[model samples]
Target: MNDFLIPQHVNSFHRANPVAKLLCMILLFMLTLFTHRLDFVFYQMACFLLLLLLFSGHRFWKISLIILPFLLVFIASSSTMILFGKGDTVWWKWGLIQISQESFYRGIHIGFKSVTFAMEGLLFVLTTPSVALFYALMQKAKLPPKYAYSFMASIRLLPMVWEELLIRRNALRIRGVRSLRGGMKWLGILKLYMVPLLAQGIRRAHRVAVAMETKAFDGQGERSYYYPSEYSKSDIWVILLLSAAVAAALLMSILLPPFGITDVRYR
Candidate 1:
């Protein structure tokens, strides 16, 4: 989870143009939406998971465990659709809940589809630095300076907010407040933390704004970047290969129909 805040050096994804990475992730997700077959969606999920493992600089099991609850929730919710949604062959029936072969297969389709998309999104987040992405938006995507700087400032402020929360909690501990392991005490602790944190946040925002102004970050003027980021041939190759993979998955779906959605419901 901390990896989201601090990106690690692992592969070329770190060096890729942020605009290109963002576009590629969006395009890949669009392709996943077009895939109706569970097998194709699983293929997409596997590809993304592999990429994450290869480039995220984190252990495979660690990442899987972090996302396991989300995957389970998606699977449960989607599979429940099999019990409630329309289908032909009834496999089970109880209190308005029913499961049919068609519905079961459909559930698998939706569940895998959700997993595939989430994996891709996590990959993008783990690999791309938020600052770099926002800067790329300013440079390549032509985002206005005011919006870009505001977003960049917010991103930089997140850690400070978290740190302030921690400091307040520690101060409470020093003042003879025992940390509750659980129960209703956590809510009270949260309430104690909020007011000071809010004031600190406002003060920090003012300081940041003042600092930015002193650095001549006027929203209307052209800004210069210390780091040179631009689209390159590699970005084109990344998109091209992704497109080809989508085309190949489609072809495979057609040729290997059994590996995809079937017309016959389970008997």
Candidate 2:
């Protein structure tokens, strides 16, 4: 199967611009934050998921499962709150907890609301690499270079932390300290995990400082990069395409009724 996420061949879209995607992603985050309408929110989530699926391989589905717990809780609680709470019109009530027509619709709305925001974040992280994103922000967006470097460095450190945790967890398992079920025991387990992780993090930081010093690392203003990024024709198209997509979603949102199109009548 051909990989879609990274793209085997740097197509016109991917090749010409990294900044376009960054801008689009930032726009996506802002869009999700701005809207409370479920339909518009769903449109954004749908677009995000559709894009991820197109670019990402079948493993994309697996990647999405990373947030299954959040989805499950969101759906479950939203449904419970929506169905069993009383408001404007009471469908049914159990003393303090009453199921109302308004509550039910609200619950469904809340579920989709959470899902939309989650997908926006997922899309950004899945598509953008840390270093590339940082480079774009620093050079293209003219952001602080130190901020970019720190962001990139944190991202780079993630894998090492994951590996260290995995190793420590495995060692604990081998020593019959596998299950973290008890009270203080859990804290002990956390300490066991943290000791090596913190030590390594500090060690890595010092090494990075030393390496930078050895290379005469001066965090100065206006640094130049080797692979200079320039906006191309495709970059222009990407920005245009993303703009059109967002506009369409917004247009649809305004055309639709304020509290949603149809009223629900639950029997």
Candidate 3:
């Protein structure tokens, strides 16, 4: 199940102009940050999922599962907070626990807002090539050259990580080595996955260090970029759109403080 939900090795999005993907991330992140309205956030998240469906793989509902556990946690936490929270409108009371209308509102608010936050983040993580994303960030954001190179060193390691995990999984099942009841439990399976993965990871880390040394990766000196990470007209358009979205959220927050627009507030 984890393997299914973890995004596939998709090279499709690579065809999109790197700049376009960057713009999309910026706009979605801006929407996430500036919008205080829960409904707007929810809508934005839905829209992002929709984008994933339309753009790369339309089978998002089948593939996307990471949203579930976090949503469950937030719903539980917020419900507990609201039930015990001190507020003016007490819905019910017991010897040790009380449920208030105010608490209910607050919890629902937090839960819905959290959905927005998580979905906002998925925009960058689920889509967009890491190398291209980092290049755009470092170049346009003016990150220090030495830091960018060091950061990129880690980003470049992901393929190695993925390959190692893939190979390990294949090797285990092939060897016919049953571990703790033929992988009857997820925990048992996780052990099979992790032990070999960790070993490979440690080995890869050492190899990476040696490779970096061979390439003379001394961050103490100046460096040159292989890709021209310069900005274009699309970047300006993206920035302006983001600014407008932020301004709109701020305006709405100030004007409509009473009639909130997000979550399960329909009771």
Question: Compared with the true structure, what per-residue lDDT tens digits does model 1 show for residues 7-94?
Answer: 5455566667889989888888887877666667766666666666776666667677767886786777687778777888789889
- Model 3 C-alpha lDDT per residue in residues 1-267, reported as the tens digit of each score: 134434544533433435565666666666565554564554444554554454443255653565567668677767876777767778889877888776677666666566655654554455555666566655566555545556677666777778878887778778985555544576877888888878877787678777776786544444566666665664555445445554555555556544464433334
Tell me how many residue pairs clash in candidate 2.
2
Q: How much does candidate 3 score in TM-score?
A: 0.59
Measured against the true structure, the TM-scores of the candidates, in listed sequence, are 0.78, 0.74, 0.59
Q: Tell me the lDDT of model 2 at 63.
A: 57
Highest lDDT scorer: 1
Q: Identify the candidate with maximal TM-score.
A: 1
lDDT of 1 at 90: 89
Candidate 2 lDDT by residue in tens digits, 189-266:
778889988999889877876776566434667678755667778777666766666777667666864457232323
The regions of model 1 sitting more than 4 angstroms off are 1-12, 54-70, 171-190, 262-267
Report the number of backbone clashes for model 1.
0
What's the residue-level lDDT of 236 in candidate 3?
59
